[model samples]
Target: MLTRTEGIVLRTQKYGEADLIVTYLTSDRGIIKAFAKSPRKTKSRFGSSMEPLTHSKISLWGKEQASLPKITQSDIINSFHQVRDDFHDFISVSKLVEMLMALSPENIPNKRLFTFFLNILHTVKASEQGSKDVLHLITQIRLLATIGYAPRLKGCGRCGGKGLNFYPASGTILCSKCAGTPVGEGKSFVRIHDNTVRFYTHSIEWPIHISNRLKPQQVILSELSTLLDKHLTYLLSKKLQSSEFLAGVRG
Candidate 1:
């Protein structure tokens, strides 16, 4: 059987010598891995369509329950090379990709998530260099919220009381009373600034296109970024490789 779908290349891993294992977030299928034959050769039909973050219309040949379908054809809708080419933007966006891959399950149909990710790619490509930092940070916050992984900052997750310390293990702010409770006892927390909470709230509440208008101070960006890293680290059980690279670059 043959299947047709629109997909954005999330990542590609080399298989054998010339073949490749391409993982994509698709319009019809949430996240799928397709095997491509010899796309690495000098004169392959795929061209650059298999590159990471490329949006392509793809044809897969396989059975209904095939674990790994074979990709027979792929035509590029957008290469997104501009985002891939820039070192800073690419690394930042890579963190989002890593998060998506980690948090989202495979072979589930999620059209809304697919559209959200595609819009993110376009937003990153068109955004000005000066605003990319805030844009990327906003994107991260939005992505987490969309997928229900966003950390709670506005109030305590359990009691909705006021709190300044964000507990990564709980993935939310915990009030002093709540923190002293048995369930929250002994867990460490990061003290977040009020400005960071305000910026995060707006990031999720406001629309993405107008996100560039939000000019947060560098300290706010750093604070939120670190908080998110801790949240994801606890959830994923390890730190993301791209995040470490980003830290090294910024440091």
Candidate 2:
């Protein structure tokens, strides 16, 4: 069967000599892998629609049981040329796509994740003052929320106290009193600064439209990155290679 959907190209790789294997995050089908014939050739039908970070409308045909679907037609909806023009923005967006491809499950319908990815791309492309660190932090927080690993930022997860601190290992907030206590076997709480706590609390409550209003301090960004790293390691059992690469690039 042939089907049409809106999608963002996540990544592409050469297949054989001239063909391409493209992975995309689609509106209806989550993550889909499709074969694009002769995408590298000058006269190829797929054109730039197969390029990473390209948003497009795609038509694919394949058997229901086929692992790799074949793209029959594609039209570029947005090329995000401005982002591509800058090396920093280009790498940041590429890392975002790599993270999504690694973390998101195959063939699962997650509209929130899809929207988050689209919004971040748009932000990166449209921003006059670009900060890749800010974009990376936003993506981390939203990815956690989308995948059901979002940390609690309200009352304490243990004692129900209003004053909260994040425990990254467990993805919960603990009160000052509760922070001293051991959460589980061999697990201890990390002290969260007031600003860091406030940052997480505000981020969780604010709508995506107003998220830009919350400017996280550098200390808060570092803490959040540490928190995400610990939690992701525990959950995914693997370190994000792109994060290391991004850090090196920024340095």
Candidate 3:
């Protein structure tokens, strides 16, 4: 059977001499892989629509349980050309796609994750200079929330106190009393600043809504990145290469 859906291109790789295997994070199907014939050759129908970060309407045909679907047609909706023109923005967008591909599973339907990715792409392409980092941070927060690993920021996850500090390993906030205890068997506690706590609170509670209005300082971005890195590693059960590169760049 043939089906049409809106999807965001997550990644692509050479499949054969002239074909490409493209992975998409679709609105209806969480993560899907489809084969595009002759995408590498000139005058191919797939064209640039198979590129990472491309948003398009796609037609696919296959059995529901098939690992790879056959792509019948694809129409580009947004290519995010501006991101391609800027090196930093391009890298940022690529990392976002890589993160999605790493975290998402095949055949499951997750509308929130789909919209989260699309919104990040749009924001990265539309923002003026110097907004890439801010946009990236916001997207990471949203992605965490979409994947059900979002941290608690309102009160301590350990003690439920109003005054809170984040423990990345647990993906939750901890109060002063809770902070004194070791979060893990061997790991020591790291003290979090009040401002850092507030920033994370906002990131979790308000997301893009509040993050868009407030510009976080470099220190805050660094701290948040560390926290997110720990959480992602815990959830994925491994470290992300793109995240490692991103951290190096930020450092």
Candidate 4:
């Protein structure tokens, strides 16, 4: 079968000395692994357009029922090379793609998530210097929400009261009244700033390109990173490698 899909190049791996196996997050189909003939060599034909983070319209042929398809043609819609060129942007974009590869399932269509990711990539590509870590945190939180792991940010988890505390393990927010109860054995609760909660909850609704406009304080960014890191690492069961690079550069 022949298929045309709009997708972003999530990542690619080398194959058989000269070929490339590419993974794409498509608008119509979920995730597809398609082989590109001789994409690696200098004069191959499928040029730099298949590089990670490039949004492209791809033409592929082969069946979807059993075996993966071969990408007969590809054209870059948005090269997004800016993120790759700048070290600062690379840290965040790599982590974004890494998380998507780890979390997103194959052969499932998630058009909304796809669009959200593209918007953020555009923002990352255009962002000027000013704590890119803030954008990374906001993106992670929003990505979690997009995939249905959103933490409770408004009202109490137990009593429906406002001005709550966040529990990373339970992925919920609770009122000061309910904050006294055991969130989990050995789990301690602290009063995270109301502003942080507000920002976190609002992050999901914030237009992706505009996410970097509201800057959280450096201390708040640190706190959010620690808490979110713990929660996401626990859920993912593996520490994200791109985080090491991000932290090293920022530090």
Candidate 5:
């Protein structure tokens, strides 16, 4: 069957000598792995559309029960090349792509998530005066929310109260009164400022467009990042490799 969809290129790998195995987050389809024949040679048709972070309109040949579809055509909708050129931009984009690739399951249609990803690529390119770190954190928090793992920020997870403390290991945001309650495998906790709590609450309530410019202080950003890092690690049962890459890129 011939399938047409527009998707963001999550990553690509060389398949044999001249082809690529491309992973994409599509508008209609959740995730797809397509094989592009001979995209590496001189004057090959795929060009740079297969590069990571490129959003492309793609055509694929789907086979019944196949591991990956064959790519018949690809057109660059927005290469998003600028996002990769700046170190700051690249770090943020890499984190978004890698997290999405890791947690998003295959072939499950999620239009909201797909549109959010596209908007972010555009936002990162258009941003002039903003905290890329804050933007990156917002993106991560939003994805976690969409996937039903968002931290409970408004009230305690164990009890209903407005005063909350962050517990990373059990993935709960507990009220001050309930915060000391022991959780299994008690993991470390990060000190979250009032601003960080507000940031976390706002992210859960607002859309990305509204939350894009919320430049929290560097201290708050660091605290929230540490909190979410622990939360995500606990949920995924592993550290994110893209985070390591992001640290290296930022430094």
Candidate 6:
């Protein structure tokens, strides 16, 4: 069977000396891995279309349930070279991609998630370098919300009580009353400012294209970023590999 779909190269692995295994987020197939024979050679049909972050139109040959399909053709639709070229931008987007792959199930068709990610790539590419820090942060928050992994910071996770502390283990805020409960007791919490909560709420409610309209203070960005990192670490059982690199770069 031959399958045709548009995809963004999430990552690629060397299958042997010459062959490659490419993982992609597809328009119709969510996440899928396809085998590209000898794309590493001096002369190969895939060219640079298999490069990570490249969005391409691809044709795969295999059965519907095949774990790995063979790529027959891949034509570049958008190389997204700019995103991969900038160290800061690439690292920021890479963190999101890591989180996405960790959370999104493979071979599950999610057109909305696919389109949202493509939009993020375009937004990051077009955004000015100076403002990318905030843009990238907002993108992370938005992506989490889009995928239902966003941490709830507005109010208590159990009840609607007001709270300023976020428990990474619970992935939400917990008022003092709620925190006194057995499950919440002894859990560490990050004391957050109301501004961080307001900014987070806005990031989720506002449309992605207009997310730039929001201008948060540096402190708020840092606060929210740290909270998210903790939340993700708890969810994934480890920090995203790119995050430490990003922190070092920013430092």
**Highest-lDDT candidate:** 1
The candidate 4 region of ten consecutive residues with least summed lDDT is: 182-191
Instruction: State the C-alpha lDDT per candidate.
Output: 0.90, 0.74, 0.75, 0.76, 0.78, 0.90
User: What value of lDDT does candidate 1 attain over all alpha carbons?
Assistant: 0.90
Q: All candidates' TM-scores?
A: 0.92, 0.79, 0.82, 0.83, 0.85, 0.92
The sequence of per-residue lDDT tens digits that candidate 4 reaches over residues 1-251 is 88998989988988898888888888888777888888778853366878888899998899765357888888888988888888868886777677777777788888988888888888777776775777778878887787777667677777778855666656677666676666443354445777777677667787867776677776777767767776666556533455566679999
For residues 1-251, what per-residue lDDT tens digits would candidate 6 score against the true structure? 99999999998999889999999999999999999998998554375999889999999999997999999999999999999999999999999989998887899999999999999999999998677888999999988998999999989999889999999978899998888887635488899999999999998888877888889999999999899989988877644455567679999
- Pairs of colliding residues, candidate 4: 30-108
lDDT of 4: 0.76
lDDT of 2 by residue, 200-234 (tens): 76666676556777788888888877776666665
Error of 4 at 204 (Å): 2.3
lDDT at 244, model 4: 65
Residue 58 of model 5, lDDT score: 90
Note the residue pairs that clash in candidate 2: none
Name the lDDT value of residue 186 in candidate 3. Answer: 27
Candidate 6 residues lying further than 4 Å off, grouped into runs, are 43-45, 183-186, 238-251
The stretch of ten residues in a row with the least summed lDDT in candidate 6 is 237-246
Summarize candidate 1's per-residue lDDT along 72-165 as a digit string, tens digits.
9999999899999999889988999999998888999999999999999999999898998898889889999998999999899889999989
In angstroms, how far off is 158's CA in candidate 4?
4.1
Superposition TM-score, candidate 4 onto the true structure: 0.83
Q: Taking the tens digit of each residue's C-alpha lDDT, what string does model 3 give over 23-113?
A: 8889988898888888888865477888777899999999876789899899999987787788988876776666666766678988888
Model 5, stretches more than 4 Å misplaced?
43-45, 176-184, 238-251
Error of 1 at 8 (Å): 0.6
- Candidate 1 residue-wise lDDT at 123: 91
